[model samples]
Target: MGVAWPFADRNEGFREGLELALDEINRQGVLGSRIRLIEKDDKSSVTDGLTIAQAFANNSELTAVIGHRSSAVAVPASKVYDHAGLLLLAPSSTAPGLTAAGVDRVFRLIPDDTQIGSTMAAYAHAKRFNNVAIFYANDEYGRGLANAFEDEAKAVGMQTVDRLTDYKDLNDLRRIVAKWKLLGCDAVFVAEVMPDGAKFVSDLRKAGMKVPVIGGDGLDAAALADTAGGAAEDTVVASIFNPFAANEAVRHFVRSYEDKYNEAPRKWAAQGYDSLKLLAYALEQAGSREPSKLAEALKRTKSWQGASGPHSFDGSGDVRDMPIILKQVKDGAFQYLTEGARANE
Candidate 1:
């Protein structure tokens, strides 16, 4: 097995979870012989991701890989993994096109952008945020999710007041805020990843534009509150995993993860653990190490519960009907919002 993703501190929990799962899988003798993990830091760069993909593909010892966190890196790398006949499970990449490419060996553990975006849009509409503004990154993840949200918002009888992309400077963000204010947008949705995403929220609050802010999983990080300060408060984020979930599988994983890492697991961590365990299950079901057989086994999976949630891949290699959790930042932590709780509450 090969693990390739950005090794930034922001994703350290993911590494911890992956290592913990690897330890458990090997200890349990899931594959008869011990399975080894070769890890590569893609640095969240497209060039580095492609390099890791090619290197992993060239290795005859590696039959499977949990690869790339962002779709910008994952989508292109999937082609390389597929051509090499290696099974690739993307733990967090959410661009809809990741599974649209007809790569049989590529599977996504997280729900796609369409599900994530529409979930957020529906939540916004339910909250009476009838007029909203969208600000998204220029990358694939941002563009794909932004489009999905826009479509869903329109369908749900909500109007998108304004849309902005790839703001070149703080001035651009300020301009966007002013325009949104003038347009009477009740909410704002940001679709960029960390640092930039956090920065945007921070800037918006600093500029005194405090309409309700919402985002997809790209903004679902513990660091968001710290980075954005008070600006992150009341911000609703859509995620695949909720640490406070009542599921028995989640409770067990959380206890074990805290025992090992001395901290609560985040969305990425849970998904990483699930990816490895799912692969191990597929290996056992296939009764062979052949990549083709593992791929078939994975597609045949149904109601396989993981630390995050139940996972069953559809024909497109995307997880089917996976639950999306809505969380709000409060007192510098993410708390799962019950259906009865309002976005601000």
Candidate 2:
């Protein structure tokens, strides 16, 4: 197992989840062989991820690779894994292109950003926010999410006023706010990771823009509240799991996570746990460590209950029929709003 993250110090949730997963694998004896985890810090760089993935691929002992938290890194790192014929399971890389990257060994536990974008679009349409502006990171994850949201919003008769793409510089945000204001957008959607999303919201609010801001799962981290301060209050984000779901399974996972970590498990942690659990199921079913056989077993998974929800893959090797939750930020925290089923339904 290889745990990849952009910054070694920043991704505490992922680190914690990786620890829990390793302990669980040992405790449950899920794999017939003793599983060992190899941790790699991609430093949130695509080049670093690719290099580390190549190094892991060269190692014969590693049966599977478990993470590359950021989609930007995961997208390129996937090529390395594909060339090496190593199975890779991502806990939270939700970029859309991953499904069609022509990599048979790559799989993800969380629904792609496209799924979140569609859900947010439905929520926006339901609320009558017909004219919206979009601010997205100029990366694979952000671009993919923005595209999906735009398609769904258009399908529902919403008008896209402005689409601004940003990278690296914080000063570019002022220009985006001005553009959105000029377009007379009723609502604004931001597609970026927590750090970028926080800065975008903070900058938007500083510019005295008061439109309701919405975002994808990238803004689902607790750090967003700290980074955006009051700006994040009342902001809405869409994600795969709702901690407040009525299911007993979800409640149990929440309690277990809180008991273990003394804090609420973020969506990242939940996805990590779910990803490992899914892998364990496939390993048990396949009864072998062979990558091809394990991949086949993964495809056949059905009704497998996870911390997030019941997950099963579709023909594209993506989770099928998953439910998305629209969550609103209230009192500096993310609160559940409503649930939407997959678009195919």
- Residue pairs with colliding backbones in model 2 are 6-43, 6-44
Q: Model 2 compared with the native: what TM-score?
A: 0.91
Ten-residue stretch with the least lDDT total in model 2: 336-345
Residue-wise lDDT of candidate 2 within 36-99, one digit each (tens)? Answer: 7778788888788888999999999877888787888888888788788888887777887777
Give lDDT per model, in order.
0.88, 0.80
CA lDDT of 132 in candidate 2? 97
Off by over 4 Å in 2: 167-179, 339-345
The top-ranked prediction according to TM-score is 1
Residue-level lDDT tens digits of model 1 in 64-91: 9997987999999999999999999999
Error of 2 at 258 (Å): 2.5
